[model samples]
Target: MMERRAYPLRISAVVLDAMQRWSEDELRSLNAQIEFVLRDALRRSGRLRPPPADPMDDTDGD
Candidate 1:
């Protein structure tokens, strides 16, 4: 079970546009890319825990 939570988030149109462009360039879904980037930043800034490794990082135990 996951805990429910919410936080106020605000972003300017210019920032949103830049995020979209970056997501496209990275070949990731916009939501996924945003989550990845934000999570990484938060972890680095001590605002959140480091994100767990993506399943894609697993290679059949090899």
Candidate 2:
């Protein structure tokens, strides 16, 4: 599991309601849906880097 931190956010009711509906449709909690959207945007904008490869999972056909 990934470490998580909570922060206060203020959003308009319209946006919040839409997000709630979308999250329910996707079967994810509101918090997870919000994080997913933020993370996706960050990745698309090249502002977030991918995690390093795990050395223990090397699969080179030797």
Q: Using Cα atoms with residue i matched to residue i, what is each candidate's TM-score against the true structure?
A: 0.56, 0.82
Evaluated against the true structure, the overall lDDT of model 2 is 0.93
Lowest lDDT block of 10, candidate 2: 53-62
lDDT of 2 by residue, 1-62 (tens): 45778899999999999999999999999999999999999999999989878777768965
User: Could you list the CA RMSD of all candidates, in the order they appear?
Assistant: 5.5, 1.8
Cα lDDT for residue 48, candidate 1: 95
lDDT, each prediction: 0.82, 0.93
Q: Which stretches of candidate 1 lie over 4 Å from their true place?
A: 1-9, 50-62
lDDT of 1: 0.82
Off by over 4 Å in 2: 59-62
Candidate 1's displacement at residue 13, Å, is: 1.2
Tell me how far candidate 2 lies from the true structure as C-alpha RMSD in angstroms: 1.8
Candidate 2: clashing pairs of residues: none
